[model samples]
Target: MTDTTKPRIVITYCTQCQWLLRAGWMAQELLSTFGADIGEVALVPGTGGVFQIDCNDVVIWERQRDDGFPDVKTLKQRVRDQLEPGRDLGHIDRA
Candidate 1:
């Protein structure tokens, strides 16, 4: 079970675009980096070329608005920033 008190991450991807693998991979990456720091990483299916990542209820990454996908480092940084603004992700912060 997830801790509701912690932050939730939602990755919504376009099902029609076959972005499941991409979304799943991103979820895995977030989980790997955040571990128990995060509440849960959910893979939500969507359409219309949507690929977005949300931390809590805030939209962190939107494909259309951001103009394409984020690299793993940027994703991590964004998530870390949202969850804990002052928290340093070691190498991630440096890189």
Candidate 2:
């Protein structure tokens, strides 16, 4: 988490649903928001619900432990408001 070189993003998913879909959605959201800042976002299959985003390097974002994905809109707003722009999003730990 202290690593500044990695990409920072949160990916959430439904406990009963496939995490890949959730990760894909998260990638889409990031692409929509950050655009070129994020080079790419991908779902890593069968890796404990991990989503990998490729920008400067490969940054991994894990889904919430519990069921149900977080609202993308809310997450975007939170990152925009709470997190410093250009800083790694992975450094921010959610409750």
Candidate 3:
């Protein structure tokens, strides 16, 4: 198997949290934000309050560590920073 240059995003959310909708929504958010610049977005089932976002195996967000779920804009920004540093997230980039 081979990995592409574009980032592959993985969203692992806690089934215990009932976070499938949240994970799926985040996946859709990532896809819409990055468009063709990204390789793929996948959702994985997890437990123990786990809700993490990863790109190319690099962890972007962790719920317990970070303390909570990220806003869609924040998550997109994290992804942009890792996958496409030069990407302009437009209004979403403003801090």
**How many clashes does each candidate structure show, in the order listed?**
0, 1, 0
The reply for model 3, stretches above 4 Å from the true place, is 1-3
lDDT of 2 by residue, 1-95 (tens): 23445345544333344666666776787667766543334344544443333233322222343233456654554445433444545434344
* Candidate 3 lDDT for residue 57: 94
Q: lDDT tens string, model 1, 1-41?
A: 88999999999999999999999999999999899998899
How well does candidate 3 match the true structure in TM-score terms?
0.90
Judged by TM-score relative to the true structure, which candidate is superior, 1 or 3?
1
Supply candidate 3's per-residue lDDT for 74: 85
Better of 1 and 3 by lDDT: 1
lDDT of each: 0.94, 0.48, 0.88
Q: Which structure is stronger by TM-score: 1 or 2?
A: 1
Candidate 1: worst 10 consecutive residues by lDDT? 86-95
lDDT score of residue 9 within candidate 2: 52
Predicted model with the maximum TM-score: 1
TM-scores for all predictions: 0.95, 0.44, 0.90
Residue 7 displacement in candidate 3 (angstroms):
1.1
Worst 10 residues of 2 by lDDT: 53-62
- Cα RMSD, each candidate: 0.8, 8.3, 2.0
